[model samples]
Target: MDNGSFALMQQLEQLYIDHHSWLSSLLRRKLSNSSDAADLAHDVYLNLIRKGGVPSAENCRRHLTQIAKGMVIDLYRRRRLEAIHLEALREQPEPLVPSEEVRALAVEALSHVDAALRNQPSKARQALLMHKLSGMGHRDIAAELKVSVSSVEKYIASGLRACTPYAVKRRPFR
Candidate 1:
């Protein structure tokens, strides 16, 4: 390995050795679970390694804490999203409920769709959802959205193109 890379690795190792236990303790107190705390602590170092800059010794603890806090927020966000998805599933009729695998796929697809729509205009997102999810015709969507039929088509096309990369292909269920 190159000298600089080797030096960075050594610094990271020292940082891990110095702060791991304290970070884990802090995470444990916040998370209320030893295993989750340990995992998150490990992830913090991994993030730092990926980021490739060593903090000054004086600021190391503060830097690590900030990274850990961001990780915790991301973890909480995922958990909250999963809870919301589960609650929505629970509200569906029993016969309409999907298998676990299907549900997972659906949730993943929905996440991608949501992300793709995030930067889109509100009317475009609404038009796309109405057409795809509600099975509304272009003309109906245009009427509902108070736009021209051609505008509805354009919006739907734009949204679909944005999400096309994330589309799940059909496969026979095992």
Candidate 2:
């Protein structure tokens, strides 16, 4: 390896020894996957090398943590986009081609929430579930529920609040 590359590798080895577990656990608490944490930690090391490597362990740790957190947020945002895209795809007979496996997981999450809402009796719940699973608009749901459009919107918002946390928790979904 080139001298610079070798030096960076050595620094990364030291970083892995010092803070890897801490970084992974921190990421897991705040983010989704341990694999994500490990990948981001490696990215932190790569960024450090690209920036000529930070001098102090304290600075490096802080920098790495910041990068890792940013990566976590970015990943979450991407997943959210994938979910939106997945819903939009269902409008078409053809499926949206997913570059990531998590897209299926996202669809399954929507399915789970839909299944849960099926047992609830509120017309509001039904309206919201129809919008979510069938891609119905507020006006459409309002017509079906015989409610005002604004009421349909409110139902959808409330339903999301009820469902989002539960959806986020059930991981490795089948």
lDDT of 1 by residue, 1-174 (tens): 999999999999999999899999999999999999999999999988888988999999999999999888867866777788889999999987778998798778867766787658899989998988899999999889899999998998999999998787777766
Instruction: Give candidate 2 misplaced runs (Cα > 4 Å).
Output: 50-52, 93-174
What TM-score does candidate 1 reach? Answer: 0.66
- Model 1 clash count equals 0
Error of 1 at 112 (Å): 6.4
Best TM-score among the predictions, by candidate number: 1
The C-alpha RMSD in Å for every predicted model, in order, reads 7.1, 14.8
- Candidate 1 clash pair list: none
Q: List the residue pairs that clash in candidate 2.
A: none
Model 1 scores a C-alpha lDDT of 0.89
Error of 2 at 171 (Å): 37
State every prediction's TM-score relative to the real structure: 0.66, 0.47
Ten contiguous residues minimizing lDDT sum, candidate 2: 92-101
